[model samples]
Target: MSRQMCERPDCGRGPIDEQGFCDVCDRPPLPAPPRPVPRDGAAVRDGAAEPERTVRAGARVGVAHVRPDPWYGLGLVDADQAPDVPVISSDPVAEAHRFCPDPSCRQPVGRGHGGGPGRTAGFCPHCGTRFDFDRPDGLTIAGRYDVARVVGSGAYGAAYLAHDRNLATQVVLKALHRSVAKTARHERDVLVGLRHDSIVRILGYEPEGPHLVLEYVPGEPLSARDGDRLETLLAHGVRVLQALDYLHARGLLHCDVKPLNIIRFREEGPAGALDRVRLIDFGAVRSHTKDTGPVVAYTRAYAPPETDPEHLRPTPGFDLFGLGMTLREVCRSRWTDPATPGVDSLRLLLDRATDPERPWWRFVSARQFAEQLSGVIRQVVAAAPTCRQVTRPSALFGSMPEPLHGGLGAARPLAHWVAARADESGLLDILAPFSSPEPGDVAAALPAPLSDPDDPGVTGPAGGALAESRLALRRRDAVSAAERLTAAALPDWHWLSDWYRGLVALADGRPERAAEVLNQVRRALPGELIPPLALGLCAELCGDGEVARAHYRMVFDTTPALGAGGFGLARVLLLAGERAKAVEVAEQLAEEFRYEREARVAAVRLRVVVLPGRARPAPTGEDVDRARAALPGLDVDEAAAASLRAEIQYAEFLRTRDRLKLSDAVRALGPHAATEREYVALVDLANRLRPPLGRGRQGRRGRTGRSRFGAASGRLSS
Candidate 1:
């Protein structure tokens, strides 16, 4: 058989290896040449381009939609208006303290001594190295690119604005400095195969000056303008993560991911001008598989502290660390409000992304990073009252079977309607709507964290053991679950093992232990919301209202799609006697799609419910009126509606001690009783609440040993 020639360009017709790589170049063979299609729709030969299909307007490569959440520009205030592009100086002057381009001699050369003006062009005094700061004068690169001026410079090289003579468009000529010349071909190879929208495109490479011809992105660095929303900056961070994901999949790493390498500009969309970001400058690009040597090109400020620039291994974590620092730097100016909805989540995300501790603790994949970042963006956008973000289910956690709304979301029980009792003052106290559910119920109700497909523990016996343990927990067989967890030989540091242990503890009603174990998972996956959510439940169970509040707020403020977080936060806030804040939480939750009805009911209840003897202040007249007005229009069953009305009327009765309000409350409870016996009991309670025929409005103020529904209650018991 004839030896196949490698199809890679400029490979000098190298033989193709069994691995489909060029033997001479050690790179994957380039894709087959595109065949040309006749303009008249006639097929001439096999070496022709495929017929183009009609793609939709918003079509994209790889995935239909890369970003799950639509970009909300500047907190919904300037979403329709694109950010103004910074005007680039065509003829820019070099900085005064310009350094030598040589890597070995980076001493400042252009600085003025005493009163003399700095020389724009000179030799470095310290190392006798030639340095030039003068703008390119009539410089034409590769006969096709006309160099204009130096746009920017970095550790690897200086980028110049140049015009492509044949293409009639502007391009960037990244002239590699002499020190980084060896990486020029590597950077070229990395850029040639990249075709992501957020990634800058490569046109051609010239070997004479060793320059990379790149698509010119006319924009400023990823930055915060005045009035820029923090969400906008985070949105750009998410896009960078997407681009990083693409690069990492191809075994390439953009080792230097900084704000200057990301270009932000405006792109006209169907709605309006949209803010867009592009990842540029692949000078630091290296193959994670092949380039396992010393780490050379990285900004110290953005690089991981644990990594030595001279000898760090090539891992996705290195790039992720740089991205985290870049986002932190760019978002610092816009993160003015510490109380901003997604701020806490964003902080947690960056913390996990750039964790200086064990390498495994940081974000492992770009998709994982993007998932949390996108969620944070949703929260920041939804925090604005004028903005309504579309709710999407969590990819990390399964859907919750219960709303965990507690008493606020449900009607009063049949017994509550049938066996109501009056206090020593001949008045009945209204049941608080914001009562938290039993801790055990919350522990059971929280959605389980989904197994990560990328996790090694997700396969073989470890995965089977986990599934079996979860099934046992679901069956309420804590012993069996615990046994399975103990028997399984999982690694000590495996997060899945800790997660199952927490669940087992929770199932066994050991919330304190569960809290401890779940907190470990939180440390393991700081970007995830489930750990904090479970911790919130554990805290609530332990009656640590403040701790629960903090944990719930972390999850809920990040993404209301996790409805359990919202309900838990509201319940904790209610228990803390912060009624207004609790009601606000519920009202905000009502704005989200899937939890709308439950949250609406909770909001109504929160405005009026008062826990007996808890020192919780009674609802105001405005609160009562709003609750009453909202109750009738609520989308609930007749019994639930009646129960809600009864609660509202009972609240009014307690406030004013009005017989009419008390009677309305009693009448409203009729529909609440499911059985005839319960109905009769409710009627008896209503009769007992009535005013005495010969007594004043206050009646005889005295303690009664007999409960109001004592006879009916005894009858029902019999």
Candidate 2:
């Protein structure tokens, strides 16, 4: 057989492969020379009767499918101010004070002997250890980085700000101390494989100097600035958590996550100014698989108490604990506002992230920590009265179908129209406005906890059992729910199991017991809003208004997207005689498109709702007018709309004694009555409220009596 030649005429060395490429040249066969085109520009057919080519190579085509990232900044802060990049330190060589690199003896090595300038390189007098404080000022490192100055130094390494000759940008050159010089390769291995926006970028490492080249973040350490929003601080925490989660996913731990390691800066982009944070300093990063042994390096205050320097086995939790402490310290500088909306949730979040008692119970993953931290940010943003944000669905709970309106969102009862009383003046007194919904109703209405997909229970019999328990509770079969949960044989520490127990207690009308059980779940999942929301409902059912208010406010203020939480909060606020505040909450709830109609109607009713025994004042004329004005645009059914009209008219009658208007409004509701009794009651209410006829000259002398709606007979107007 003849050997196939290379595609190129001059490079015919070996046989061409099936891919039409010569093995020697490693080059694909060149494209066939362009075919000659006919003058008519129609067809170019080969003698073999080849098919016509329809799809040409490199043809301009249809729209390309591009999937852009959906995430932007968290929007918790107004990051519109562009911050100036901090200037790099000058005179770095002279500024880098001489010190022994030996871990055992880090004493001063090159200090002046007789009030003169210190030497740059020398041996430590204490341990006879060689030390080099030589500044790389003008010298190029690894033939690429032009040394600038020493920015930071520690026992393990010293960071130098250097300009990259190749990249034409500044970078950090971290040179490890001689004692831990080998760690540079370990850090480079961890960093080179990672790519996340929040994490620092790694360049090539120089083994000779044992230096790790990193992206230089031109900003200060993560901190609270003057006029900074609390959410801003928490947002930084969330970003750091994201980086940590990315690292943990790859079986790596950033064992030294602290404020100093996270750099916060401002970037100006095409869209606008943006506040950004980057996690840096991977010198202490280590593999999770080989975490056992003496800790190489870590800040004492940020590390967990259990982390002994002599024998430390670090987990992902080690980084999370450090982040928790970092945020705690930074936030302390401006954490004076106890009344801030998400402050309690923030405390709960940090507590869970750094739980001292149960080391295993602390945040199990960075993703888990981010979920709760993000929830807290929502709460903080939602606390503003004028702020209306899009509702974010809870990650840990299913949607709550119930509005839990507590009667404010519903129409007046049939009894309110039929059982009304009229005075001698032909004025009808309707039933007092509805109070709170039954606690049993609120309990059943609360959102159900969603089981974590990654949980071991999800793939076990307990998962199926938990679902069955939820179904049983929904059917009001408390007994079945309890039995299924008991049969599941879940571990005692399983939060989902306790969650079901709480639901069962609620189903059984034992809110006090439910509260106790749910509180345990809260401790287990402290960052979750679902637990607090469930607890709020339980407290409300138990009539512990104070506790309910706290819980409801926490969840609602965090994110009004949870309609149940908002409605529940509004209900208790009204019950507590905070009529104005309750109305405000309902109005805010109306801002959410999903709950707009219900929330709007609730706001109208709350303004006129009469807590008969409470100290709340009766609805004023302005309140009645407002309710009437809001009724026309309300997207409710005929019956609901008529009922709302009648409610407003009744309030108007109380304010201005407009009997004619009240009677007409009441009569308008007749067609919507579900039963004959209800219709008749509505008629009676209208008739009783209707004005009597004027008395004739001869009829004035005749005897008069009260109308049928009146308690007793009285003189008639006719």
Candidate 3:
């Protein structure tokens, strides 16, 4: 009889299989409950960590049933578009114990080797080693730590949950592979000296044995992080980059930096980005300047193209590449992200990292990489405004802006535009589909609606998405509309969901949220101008004059006659003390919309105004005469035309001493203004100021020249 090798991290000893099951826990696999979206009248989804479906009597679903504990529903979003936290699978990480005792001859021997259920007890077919997975508990080590549970076992080593008596804390003790353990001591010695906020702290070194104690971060790996978002991951990337920068400054490189080695602490916020991150499992740290050994450990998914052990020169560049790979996965988390505007810039960073041989310039240093990732992070934060969101200076755009009460008072227009360009472009035309107000109308005015087709969700069934959402919006049940779109969201067409959510937010009177959602959609699909238009409208409604002005100007500059853009820009300009520019805008609009009634009225009204904060300089003699000449063919009622002309003359009289010739003024005045209210006011004032009215039609009044006070009040009463 030969003893088989048991390779389970916790059960490292082999025992003879008995009673058809291993001595260790051998219960059947727990079925993962299906996560189905609740239908129109179906019961709501359970809010358990691993929620099981509720069963009705005689229901076809005959699996194990469990009622949701009321306590579980705490803080659940409770709406149809509730945040979906993924359930972790219960499947064991490692294969069943069936190999030989000798680690080298780890061959299968049990009956279940292929498919059929095998006798738990077996001898290795190759080396005749008894394959037993049963091992005892309460194992102690080096008279200090007690192994309480098995954490994980991998190609590199085994991790165990243990209690450290000396420190009075729960710690992780890694029992490395015998071969690697022989060399891990030197690595551990150097790791003890390394200290950083983001790097997992090494508690103590068990110098005489294979195990070492490490601070057990109470969190899951990046892959298992609950409710992850692009912003959240980008935050993690920033922290990791900081750690990497610190290590590089000390001349060390993390040869392995993948999602598996990243542990996100539970204390961190999910969305707002004020997060705590820990980089763990430094099994492959080396001196970038001096360490010239073969690559020790690396996951191929994140390792650089040049990581072949035969030529692997571990450098800061290698670790930077690893971080790039890690962040790429982070940005594209399991939670679906329709390729957002930031995706492209992030991809460039990734391409540089995973394959640096092509970039010509050696891949960027960690600090530079952090700067790039910080940009992506800021855009993400700006795109999604959260209650607790931190306002960080954007590396992509610039620094903090000067505070202002109103107006386009701060921020560089061009820099702001370029920074937000990718995100705002695709959303302007987003509402075009809703114009028809019915699902039966058309998909869009154009066949292939200009959008980023390269985005993940655009490839799915596309025709009815916008139409269905639009019709739902027409029903005025914005939440229902949002839910329908969210339910219909496929991985490839996720932007459609965001589109309707934005519309819902806008319709429901949540401009800030609507702006946030639309901005995200803009970033995700940066090929069109719809988002910018929508963003401008949102900013306008939210009273963010600067942002609205910049966005509106962008649209008007590109498409001068896009009615919304022109109107929005004019309003923003009028508020910003740009009276002349506002008049010029109206004039430009009048030219573009020649013969249009609304446009003509707008030009006349906008040409003369005195609002609270904005006091336009009095009209010049030339402007007064020009208005008088252009009044007749202004395309408005005779009364309105005459009123406009007289108003201009009144303004000129008030502001300039330039004398007006009554004869020339009468000649230039449109024929329609004879009985206009403004003309009446103008004539009455001129008569009173004339050299003693001689009982003509104007002799009814005995008023001399009206004082400035009387004149100002008279104008106000009119």
Candidate 4:
């Protein structure tokens, strides 16, 4: 009931589709306003003009169309002509801005549903529903927030753009209707305590006036934004999930999530092209742990299908559905053009996240949603023409570690078992989500294959052989994957085939061959992004850090959303002795792009080790400890950690019984201690601390015991 019904007289189109596109024109549906009453005993069509435009939030949209013709295709306006209405002001919300509550009877009753601006307060002449936004305009009830302008009105309350006398900045004053005032206080309590970039901050609240003040963001509602690109739309989607995750973590839910409640950073995306999405309107917010019954404040377009009165106590999955719906509409605005690529991948993500029946299995929570979207964004960015100049860090990578890819990397992948080990999700799925992470291997790490093959069908130019190669790689048979690709019929598919072949060659320890194959792919598909990434791999393996840095930068510069590209660039920067740039790139990868864990470790290394900009002696005990501390998560340089532990123990022994602690020192050194130079240092320290053999004393209590076990650190430093 949130949208007015299309008045084609015979057509069954709702005013807005799930994507906020008009069913008739594919344009964004106009805001619904009140319809003028019919005259002469004839049923007049409600609105005959501007049917696809949005009216004021509570204004009744006239629906007078009399069986209009059906049209299909993308709906769009001039890029420069989209309306930019900054929401919030002191003046009462315009009569044209308010819509009737009736879903079927959308008739305007305010000052000028027909001629002049309607009165500030009145009953709908056509539907007889009373509406008001006049109360909070002049009253300074809280004494600090001067309710200067009425920006908007809704079922819960009237919102006024106000001035904070103390802070001298703009803020929104929500003067809630007494019926929902308690909910307003709950919302204030929820928001005032939290601070997140993607969520609006609650400044203060006044109990007497039953109103709350929230920070004013200078942007238009997403409903007003049109023609924005799909990347920006996806960014907004990630931010929304992050906000929801933050809320769910605190046991609260913003049950009434919709496009109208989101603020686009500006008319268009930020210069960096990252969507700085801020969620507002927390009226239906309440504790997920506490059952509050069916909530009245929800928009049908983005509301989950499970809002049954008995089951209205919101769940994290429920809110996740709402967010999915909201993102769909935002994304659909730019997907009108059939020529636009990446829509299929994005729609698949949307479909998965909003799967009313089975969302939780794949995206059980916001964190999962963020992670999957991270994969989706990588594809979209790689497919994109170019990335924004600046991009935000990804949240998905926040938990991963700085992958230890050694220079000229330990010949091929260590072993099948080593290649098979993974924590969660695909382990070596660096650049192959779209190419398809060889499920066979990543899944090998798991007890079995993905229980529910969420793997998508190939919609890109690449086809079956590409998938086969990926499977082969996961099976640790890069030679066969390479051989099969070499003989495969890749006519126009040459670039795509070679791109994968280059990866296979690199996996097989043929960096020179990988470089040759990638070079061919580059010329064949100069605009193709995969070549840059593949070439970077070859370059790094060839010991040309500068060339690797350049290629990786090319990939990341063209698409910041691709984690592999950004991660590669961060790694290259670190290797190239560009500490500052490496730290910046690492932060961006971790924070905005979802490469969370790896970036954190890389940043730490840049500070404690890599950034010193000069070769130093072996890592001191403290230095090794710093490195050890940075990689706290599973799947890391275990050898480094082992050596550091041995050193710590040996140092402790130096300060205590040298010979007595020898056995424990040996335990700490781990195996392969003699192989790594760092571990060997610990052996020398242990040897120096050993009780000197007494040539004169025929039986130095432990001298004979120590001789049989000098250093005794063999098994500790693997």
Full-model lDDT, candidate 3: 0.50
- Pairs with steric clashes in candidate 2: 379-558, 706-714
When sorted by lDDT, best at the front, the candidate numbers are 1, 2, 4, 3
Tens-digit lDDT string for candidate 1 (354-410): 767666667777876776676666656666653545444444444564777766676
Give per-residue CA lDDT, model 4, range 110-135, as digits (tens): 55655556677766677786655565
Model 1 vs. true fold: TM: 0.73
- How much lDDT does each candidate structure score? 0.69, 0.69, 0.50, 0.51
Q: Model 2 reaches what TM-score against the true structure? A: 0.75
**What lDDT tens digits, residue by residue, belong to model 3 across residues 551-591?**
76655554454455665677778667675676676666555
Off by over 4 Å in 4: 1-139, 223-227, 266-275, 292-296, 307-313, 337-340, 359-362, 387-718
Task: Rank candidates by TM-score, best first.
Answer: 2, 1, 3, 4
| TM-scores of all candidate predictions against the true structure | 0.73, 0.75, 0.43, 0.41
Our model 4 lands, by Cα RMSD against the true structure, at 23.5
> Who wins the TM-score comparison?
2
lDDT tens readout by residue for model 2, 1-718: 6655655676676665432334565343344445544432222547332211211211111110111111212555566644667775543343233556554555656666677878776667789876555554565666788877778774466788889988999898887645566677777887889999899999878764567888888887887777677777877887788788778878888878888888888777887867789998877778888676656678878888754322267778889889989989888865577777777667777887776766756776776677667666766776664253545444455456577776677777666776777776755565656655554565456655444533544325554465466556656878997998897787666666677788888888888999888897887665567788888888888788999899988877667877778888998888887878988999988988878988998998887766656376778877777887887888888888877887777667677776777767877776676666666666666666666656223333324333344433222223
